[model samples]
Target: MTRYYRVLSSIIVFTMMGIGSFVLSKSFAEDEQNRKGQPIKSREQQESKASNNDLAKFMRGKLDASSQILDGLCTEDFRKIISGASKLQELSAAESWRVSTDVMYRQHSAELRGAVKDLLNAASKKNLDGAALAWTRTTLSCIECHKWVRATLISKG
Candidate 1:
């Protein structure tokens, strides 16, 4: 039963990750298409474009770190798991991660930090089961936070 549960959990996590990745890729493609259709930019537009580019780069780094964690989980590589978790913690502390001053946004950030802590603890103990569970939690936190961010942006607009 324990083994069955673990396998099921892993499948669910992977499915969620796949869906998230697909959505993100589609959104990026749409953004690129829109940019291509735009006319020449003014000074302010150019600055905004630069800022958006930086944010996109930062987000890609976060996704890479998350992928590392997934890889580690699959291979039972504790070192990779720890390294990835640490990278996530560091990224979460960056100025760019704090995209909003809203209370719910801060709560979401805190949830991610808590999930990362759990992941690190599991990795330190070399507990693959625990680490896998923590990874799922971490991924869910990220998905929820991103959903909230997108909703907030749409509402603001």
Candidate 2:
């Protein structure tokens, strides 16, 4: 029963991640369309648009790393888990990951880093249960951070 519960939980977490990815992709497409509809009147605007595109590309990389982790979790592939977690950690340290200078954003980033570290540790130990738990924490951190980002953007707008 405990094993069954663990598997069920993992399935649920992966499903949620997939759905979130789909929604985020749709949102990005819509935002891109909206930006395209606007005329860029200045060099600054063009530079800003380029920066946004770069950030979007960086975010896609993060999503890809996350998907790799999910695939590893499902397949019980410790090497893949380690590889994905390492990529995530590296990405988190990159400048692109610092999207906001806000304290809360920093806190969220720290939480994510911690979760990824936990994931790496669990994977290294070949502890599937621990890794799954860490993955769940990682996912929650991402969701919380994204919510904060969206709220902050809306408020600024």
Candidate 3:
């Protein structure tokens, strides 16, 4: 009975360790993947001149539209949002009735890109209203991204 109890305890301990290691390995791989995909700011070297400890790097989506505007990269970039072919397909693959006309729609981002392209194509003959509306939409995306993921707002102001 003593020998049997010792073997059982050893088996349980090793099994728990195996499970813990598996979970740790999975988490480590996910962290590695996230780090790999995250964009390293090119201007960080120049930006480091501030040296403020309060500065937070991550930005969020879903901020109120009236909030402050972001400079450099779009706020969407902070949300890990990307416009890869897979996302494009995912957006368009759905039924028309299922997708709303709201600006929050994933398709709206692609549409915003298209509108900007069209705006540039007609720069010489620019329609002020169209340009302005497109600009608003683009900025709104930034605001939305900030609303959700911008909890780390750091300001020395």
The most accurate candidate by TM-score is 1
Weakest 10 consecutive residues, lDDT, candidate 3? 57-66
| TM-scores, one per candidate | 0.74, 0.73, 0.25
Candidate 2, residues 106-151, lDDT tens digits: the string is 9999999999999999999999999999999999999999999899
**Cα lDDT for residue 129, model 2?**
96
Tens digits of per-residue lDDT for model 3, 8-108: 99999999999999999999999998888755566775476344321221112122211321211145321122222123224334343222344444554
Flag regions of model 3 displaced more than 4 Å: 1-115, 122-124, 151-157
Better of 1 and 2 by TM-score: 1
Clashing pairs in 2: none
Winning model by lDDT: 2
| Alpha carbon deviation, residue 120, candidate 2 (Å) | 0.1
Q: Which rank order by lDDT, best down to worst?
A: 2, 1, 3
